[model samples]
Target: MNPAERLLEVGRYEEAERSVRESLAAYPSDAALLALLASILRARHDYPAALAAASAAVAANPRRSAGHVERAESLILLIRSREAVDAATTAVTLDPSWPGGHLVLARALVAARSLPAARDAARQGLSLAPRSVAVLLTVADVERAAGHREAALEAVQAALALDPGNAYGRWLLAMLDAERLRVRKSMRALREVARDRPAAPDIIAMTWPIRGVLSGLRRGLAVGAVAVCFLLAVGHWWWPQVDTFARYVSAVLAAVMIGFAARVLVPAGRLPWRCLRLLPRLMRSASVASLVLVIVAVGALIAFASSGWWVLAVVALGAVPVLWALGLVEMVGAGLDDPGMRPALLGLAGELREWWRTTKRELREAWTADGRRGE
Candidate 1:
């Protein structure tokens, strides 16, 4: 095996960089060394340096797979997606069987939101290296982005089957279930994964808000119920002459209560719970109901405006929550179906959670050690 390949295998990236640099110094225009250095730089997220190294490698050997792949990756980091796509295409054309080339092409296609092509490239890479967890995950992501929820789930399941301890796969599955409005299942999945990997902050961050919202809504409902009962009792006793006004007030209060209830109930699927199977249908129903409410409000506003009932128009305007809920539900549904978009969205989320968990673990360890020293 080559020195560069050996260094990479052992995870000695800094040493590999120095070795490639020394080798390139002797040859002055060694394409392979330049490509290796570029790969190392890209791995380190030094996009500018990687781009320069990759450009040099391509200049020395335009036909080489590694050079093109490196250049394409750097271009992607630079957000020059169209150029990245062209470079990836060139790499694939020159080395159709190269796993790296296909991976780069797949990433570029995803960035461009060309879901079908991205899925194809990811699949091609996976076919060539069926055991590669990275390729499998990427394929799953592409499938999700393409609006194939079932396919994306299958890909994620396959990835988990291959590497059952993969935190990324488990986290992604949780997110998918949540989006589908399988609240209980989603929460359970998140809890299971998060417990095993307590270092993942993103899991807690995402889960906490949903949990809080659910709790808050429950509290609000209880408070509202009590308030309504008190108001009804007052009208029953001392406000008999004001019964007509009381009925109008009750109608308004009911509308407000219904709106609040829907807000709280509609988002219940986002929580982690045992009753998750009802999420998808609930999401669909909530979206439809919210939309209908918005439409009715719009018509009411228009009619009131025509009749100069500006006060009623202003009241109708308060129905914004229903519209927002409808939009959120629609978005959640759309995200669940597309496989190609899943990885970057879900993977990033998982990675962020992992990072947060790691940081917290380190901080806790440090704090404990400091306390021991103090004692």
Candidate 2:
């Protein structure tokens, strides 16, 4: 094996970097060496240097997909999603049969929040290489972001089946089940991941209660907020009949409630722009019956407040509990399908199976190589 390849395989990335650098100096126009350097830089998390190395490789050999894929990953790390997508697209266009390009494109599109497109690209990669752990994880992430939690869980389960020690896939399953409020599944997956990567950044930074498991408090809080909004609608409708001050309070409450709902639903901060674009579509992915219930509750509040339909207001508030129940039922139903424990157990089993097979294969190959050399 080449010095860089040997060092990289042994996880001595710094040594690999030095070896690649030395080789690149000797063969300045060697695109493969540049690609190796790009990979080394990426492994070291030196994204800017990785991007430069990858770009050099692409410039040296535009026909190769590896350089473009490396460039796309570096671009993604640099938060240049559009450029990453373009680079990845170029890679796949150059070699449609290569799963690498499709994988990169899928990931870049996911980062760009073009979820449907990301899912499509991921599916394309999977169609090309169904056993690819990378593509499976990408598809899982895409499905999760698209609110297809069951599908996402299934993808992670499949990936774990291929290579059981994939922390990223485990992390994904934990987070997905967590979001869907599957307490036992979330905790099981979360504990397994924490065992492997105790201080994983995402886990450390996670604000989710119970270490990424959805606590009762979180669900109750969301439910309470929605219920309060329905109550506000009632006030806005009936308070005018009571007094001037009461009516004024109702208006302020209604405005505040609206703002709160928007903030909670759309989410804000780092990806506010992208969230704004995706929120409507994501909202539509929610339980249809539950959504209708909430809508009817809100509409009834409006009717009572508008047409002085006091009776309708009572009916709307009465239905709030039922609507809330239905939403919870829908969420729980989704969670039941994504039982985290089963997937985690499968992953563990797969890891053991893979280890056993790999050890036996390596022993067999070594024995054969020795016999050949002796002969």
Candidate 3:
């Protein structure tokens, strides 16, 4: 591999881009350098630029499988699934022996929602280069898309075992664990990845509490609101004569709890504020709504207890469903947006299917055995 290739391999995308660009200045028609530039651009998440570079590379040499692979990857990132599949198929047709081409085809097939074909293509690449980390990662990705969590996990683990410090592999594992609700494990892995990649988008920083504290508080608040509403109903039914002084005391405690929850859960400081900028616009809006609703519910609890306003309690009760819905949206949106979380989400879906299948099979077998006994 050239110096530019080595830099790209190590995730020094900017340096690799500079190197390749310098080489391209001297050999502007160099298909290899153009493809290399495309890879660097893709790594940096500049899909448009990457696609342009890949196109240039293909124009320079249509027969070069590497150019076609880069083009396919760029198209996939752009969400042009059909075009990506076509580009990848061309690469594979040009060089059927190249594991890289097969892996690209697998990824394109995945983008096109052709899971079985994607799996076959990935397996073919793995067969060609069993020890290749890239090939293994492709297989893992295909399995994850297929909702085969165990297979995806095993493949990724193998890739990591071969190259323990592989950042992408580590990130993928973290996401895989997270999809299964292993929050602590996922957070630990994410922290390690963050340490290595400080300048990466604020997505990871935003993800910290979104996955942990926010989720916990969301569940806690939902349950707490329900319980409080139930107790209020019981009190109204059994002891209709509640003293004002006791109501005031309950209101004070509720206020304290709200203050404590805010102090602990709300992100503060310039860093957090800066990280907040990385969230999608809709997500930012949802987050604000969630925080506001949390405070509103607590405030309603205070008003209801202190002033004997039953309607305030009803308002708090009404907020629960909306709060829960917002939390669910945030969780699923984060999972879909984050590369690490996306696979985990897919894996979780697969696990759910497996669980239902197992339950159904056991039920059927039990029913059959019961029928035989009756006979």
Candidate 4:
């Protein structure tokens, strides 16, 4: 293996990039060096520049499968899924025996949403190189996208068994565990990944468990509110004359809910009031919206208890579903907000743009067809 490639594998991306560029200066048109540069650029999340490098590599040696494979990878990250599929197909055609070619083809098929084809390509790659960690990871990714979490977990575990220190494998396992609602298991694996790759952008996921706890609390609050309402109704029915006691109970319940919410929002010390101090840091509109809804719901609960207004109870109850939905939204937002996920998010945006472009083209074609038919 090249020293630069080893550096790239070990996550020394800047050093790898610098080494590749220096080597390229001596052999500017060398396909291998150009492909290596493309790989480094892709690792650094510079998809456009990576695409250019890969395209140069292909132009230098159109017959080389490695160049095509790198080109496909760059295209995939750029959200040009159809182009990526073509590039990967070319790579596979040029080197049918290469597991890397098959694996990347599987990834391209996945980007194109051809799950069955992706699975077939992934299986073909795995059969050719069962011990290859990259092949196994691609297979796992394909299975996960197909909603076969168990199969994905099995593949990931196998990959981890072969390469115990694979950070990507550990991260994938953690994500699969989290998807299965195995929170503790996910957290354990995530912490290991964090410890091993401290400077990795994936470390942002450390905040995920906190978000999960907050989301769970929101759901619990929703359910608990219903239970409290039921109990209040029962108490009122059992003793119609003692309305004061029910009002006092409602007020106490409201206060307790608010206190618990504050505690959950504040991660520091035992003081719930610390949440107020941190309020200014909640810059996201979504975060502010969630806080506002919680305040409104609590206020409505208090109003219902004090004035005996049934409308206030309805308003508070209605806020439950909204809060639950917001919790889910916030969870998704947290996952997408990470730097490591930026490339994937950019690809998603590209996919949407491509979809819109296709739609417009189809509309134009249909209009042209109608005009010819009328003539």
Clash totals for all models, in order? 23, 1, 0, 0
59: Cα error in model 3, Å: 1.8
Instruction: Write candidate 4's Cα lDDT for 1-375 as tens digits.
Output: 877899999889999999988888999999999999899988988888898999999999999999999999998876678999999999999999999999999999998999999999999999999998989999999999999998999999999999999889999998887766565667667767777776753533544444444565467557656755665676567865445554565577688776654544343222213222332232234555766877787787788788976567667677888877766666566555433356667768888999999999999999999999999
lDDT for model 2 comes to 0.68
Residue 24 deviation, candidate 4, in Å? 2.4
Per-candidate local distance difference test: 0.67, 0.68, 0.78, 0.77
Which candidate tops TM-score?
4
Pairs that collide in candidate 3 are: none
Segments in model 1 whose C-alpha atoms lie over 4 Å from true places: 1-19, 182-375
lDDT of each residue in 185-297, candidate 3, tens digit only: 66567668877778773364436544354555566656655666566666677755543443564476566665554553353323334555577665666676887887787
For TM-score, candidate 2 versus 3, the one ahead is 3
**Whole-model lDDT for model 4 versus the true structure?**
0.77
TM-score of each: 0.54, 0.58, 0.63, 0.67
For model 2, residues 1-375, the per-residue Cα lDDT tens digits are 778988887679999998888887789988889988998888877777888999999999999888999999888776678989999999999999998788889989987999989999989999999988988998898888888989998999999999888889878877786576554565566566766776443432233332121223224334543454455555577653343333343334334444444433333123222222232232223344544555565455455445554465455556656655655664554433333323434555888999999999999999999999999
Residue range with the least summed lDDT across 10 consecutive positions in model 2: 209-218
Worst 10 residues of 4 by lDDT: 268-277
Query: Given candidate 3, what's the lDDT at residue 175?
Result: 76
